[model samples]
Target chain A: MGKRPDRRESFVVRLYVADREATAVRAIANLEALCREFLPSGCELEIIDILREPQRGLDDSIMVTPTLIKLAPPPVRRIFGDLSNRGRLLDALGLTGLELSPPRP
Target chain B: MARKNQKEREPRLAKAQTGIDGVDEITGGGLPRGRTTLLAGPAGSGKTVLALQTLVNGARRFDEPGIFVAFEEGFQQVAANAASFGWEIPSLVQKRGRRSPRLAFVDGRLSPGAVQAGTFDLSGLLAAVEFRAKEIGAKRIVFDGIDVLLVMLNDPRVERGEMCRIHDLLERAGVAGVVTMSTAGLEPPGSFMLSLSDCIIQLTHRLAERASIRGFRVVKYRGSAFIANEFPFAIASQGIEVADFGTRPKYRVFTERVSSGIPRLDHMLAGGYFRGSTVLVTGMPGTAKTTLAGAFVAAACARGERALYISLDEQPAEILRNLASVSIRLERYVRSRLLEIYADHPQETSPEEQFVRMRQRIRAHRPSTLVIDPISAAIRMGGQSTVLGVAERLLAMAKSEGITTLWTSLYQGSEEAMEATPLHVSTVADTWIHLSYRAGRGERNRSLTVIKSRGTGHSHQVRELILDDRGVDLADVYTVGGEALMGTARWEGERAEVATQRDVEAEEARKRRELEILAAEIRAQTEGLERRRESLAAEMRLLDQSITLRERNESRRQQEVRARRGGEPASRAGRRKGRSAPTED
Candidate 1:
């Protein structure tokens, strides 16, 4: 897949999950690959397991699992529960309108 | 759970006691222990408060630690709300960011903005809940507003699966659980969570008579028996309390009889109603129902005992002023705190809340007598069944407190309010006094009849309730031609009776005087005749003397002219000649 870089290159994302859940793991992996591809200048990522820091999850108003937040964007955005849809993730991160090419086999 | 019996086939399921008022009784001793109870209601129907109150009661009374997982509201908000109820939740909750041994609040809310990219389970929430539950050794737990979370689960199958998992977890934990959901327009949503619930309690809050009424109905309870009727419930400052007094009756039989203020009424009731008895006075408007209640209060107060009078339609001042017209002076008693008149509009609060307030007043005042004047207003403000529930509970409360209670209802339709009272008060009331207006003789008269009085024989005849400046009393019943004559008719009949007696006495006196006069005249005439007879006798004597003298004079003159009688003989001969002429005539 080919990704077009945006003028705002730097990206910061926070991922919240609950104890290595299958959906959470999949969301984490998907987010990592997408961030590496989109944020050519590198992305700062912090992962928190809500099971351990549940109070923080509550404090931050994070109830759903596998929730990812885009921090670097001027407008904060949240995508929750298996963020495996790359196109929707891009839209949530304010990275929409990026051209997509066919995936290599 | 009920008592164990020797012949019982199976033991009932153990129950966890929710210390809320009237709740445990209605639920047959709270929700089944270690089982899930689904509370279905519309939003703002008191589902959250009910569920939370149960948790607090469980933690406070049963010494059972509990956990609350809120999905719609935050735990802090829940605690803040509970503060108004004075539940002491803040102190009992987690302290210093550590799990509280008494109770724990777990956040189960999901971000409203959170978008589901793929399928996700509620493992995180489950883990947190399980951890908190164990941390507090919770015996009870609540999943409040689980509907919000369920809606986020996005798929019915996934939601069902998650619900099953939650149910299984609670079962494994062996903690009594409560799950609240906002149903769609009062209809229970056919959800798997509902099916998994062992007990289903439906809470309803709707507008009736322009006031909100809250109630609870046990829709279903598996493997147990529960009250199926929809009983009114109120969420007051203290908490949710159901108005259910059917199971436990505090019936007390007192041998002492209390006067009904009006002595004649007491006599009609065969020495008044029993102490701690419930008396119902039913009548139409203006039949002096409140007057009777006031008389009772005055009587109780006069006995140096406290009484509570509740008027649904009148103010205390109005009642006092009106009762004063009948010489029922309650001012002094009120000043002395012997009589308390609590008046209010019946539509101001819900019937359940009214019951709670009434109970509070009874407890605070400790009155020996209680009166609810014209419960019809309350019945009209509330529905028949709703107010009936409150009325029954209120009567039970009065009975348990061992206070004489009187309730008045405005009966409509016929003069025959004697058959029964509205709201089935005839059955429960020990004395049923039906006050009716008999419109006859071009005027209305108030008559009170005792339809029934338990344990005593009451007057079968109706007595007219007479209220005058002197006081309230029952007039002496008078029947004329099989109809009771009252008011002016009675006065006229009595007046006519006295006038007839007076006329008869006058006639008798006149007849006696006339006979005496006639006898006197006859005596006078007899006296005159006697006088005349005496005169005649004298004259006859004289005549006889004259005749004898004349004969003797003649013989003497003939025999011997020489007798000296010759001179008397001449005068006697003249008198004898006159007498002879009179005798010949």
Candidate 2:
């Protein structure tokens, strides 16, 4: 009713991990689930292994591992942690305003 | 030695490829031909890998057959590792058949007696290499894990002597060779080998918080000029690679300007940087070097040009958020595949590996612009000459690929106090932008100046800069009070003092004027009061005279009545006689 057009949008979320070891692997798994649950239908996700592709990490200005970068809606957002915390991850992705259904009884 | 006839022309010297992707540019093509190059490093520093990659690259890419001698790992292990990196070494060996280069794997437990008492079995190693080289017409050779040979000998003197012998033999064979030595804790015992060899490259592995960094320096390269600094490198699945990091002019056919994403900064650079040019930015710590690099990447991305940012110091998340404060949003670009960010420390890997990784990434991304923020960290990780060699190679690669490369150098201490930049980056840079902080008139100020730009016209004067929520802005060049304050500290102090002094002087002058006006008003009022008093005195005197005249007339009238009534006739007659005389007078 606000007269604003409901335009479909798409974006990419990049994750940079220090080493492709267990910690990075687990973080990636959690991030994938969080993205599926919280992100819109058109959104995409990517993970960059800094150790394997160190040059890509440098080019992206990624120094630390397990860093999540949100690229959408013009202004970009980034979170530096595992994406297991649902509330914090959503806030970091700038998806705080999206509504979710209540838990089933 | 063969003597040339005076009239006859001298033959051109054959060049040796450094095996680094773009290193040919710095050394005028490559290392000196038919000379030994000592490559030294600590344990797990990828020295062997670097030497192997150079040999393999020469063999496969340049069609130059090479010989590799391994003192530690077996031939199969080395081949397996190479395979994981997408290289088919076994096939290459099979293709050459009997002419292929030989891989000599020596068991570490081999006794000293087998080495011939005090003499190392140089003849045996030489025979194997010579046999392979003759079969394959090989021109290059590499010694993998020389430290094992030295350790097995158990005598520094013996090691030095054997290295000298090997150096002489390699020179005599007319074969270009690279010897990899383990530096671990011992001071490079290969100094003897390095001194005898035509070139010496020192590799270092540094561990920094959660990241591994590798660096390399060229100690000496005879018969050719090389960049002189430690350069960042890495080890990947394929092999060792080096980041061609240096301060060199980037040459391109195009003469177009590229935006920096920030409007005000674009004006400061005389309308942004030229396309495919190298820009060197030198500044102190926390002067926004990373932020500026990020902004440039963002601008390139907005224009649909692929941009790559290489960070050698910080983590990706930290850098991204820091840039976000300046309104440089990298997340969007990353998602769009328009911007690529690579972050690593200098200690986790080797310079050769880092270089290979960079080359692969660049080839895949094909970015229009590339940025390395604070190249000093990478340089610090290696020796001066080695870093320079890497820089030289990087410059060539960027120029050939037509990618605009921007590098930031951290200049420690005060800008004015520093006699020279940390690295001699100005020598290789096409456009050198120097940033400094100065304290003037009790205020700190920041200024930026362009030292030089190869082909483009730029502002020579230093301009003041401001960083805020809206991004960086260049203020007018300060010219107040004959002293130019360089940062916010000095500028603010000068302004506040000038304002306070002016305000105090203005207040005192105002007070003096008010006092003078009050005095004049008081004098005017006193004069009016005196005139009114005088006028009142004169009126009183006139009234007194009128009253006195009336009284005298009334007395004369009364005296006449008394004389007519005859009551005071005698007194009036006597008084009339005296009064008549006075009246006549």
DockQ of each: 0.27, 0.00
Instruction: Give the top-scoring candidate (DockQ).
Output: 1
Candidate 1 versus the native: TM-score? 0.77
Pick the TM-score winner: 1
DockQ-based CAPRI category assigned to the predicted complex of candidate 2: incorrect
The lowest-lDDT stretch of 10 consecutive residues in candidate 2 chain B is B111-120
Q: For candidate 1, give fnat to 2 decimals.
A: 0.47
Looking only at chain B, model 2 earns a TM-score of 0.52
- Tens-place lDDT per residue, model 1, B512-571, is 999999999999999999999999999999999989988986785555334433655777
TM-scores computed on chain B for all candidates: 0.75, 0.52
Point out where model 2 deviates above 4 Å.
A1-105, B1-55, B62-73, B77-250, B282-286, B347-364, B379-402, B410-412, B424-472, B475-479, B482-585
Give me the overall lDDT of model 1.
0.80
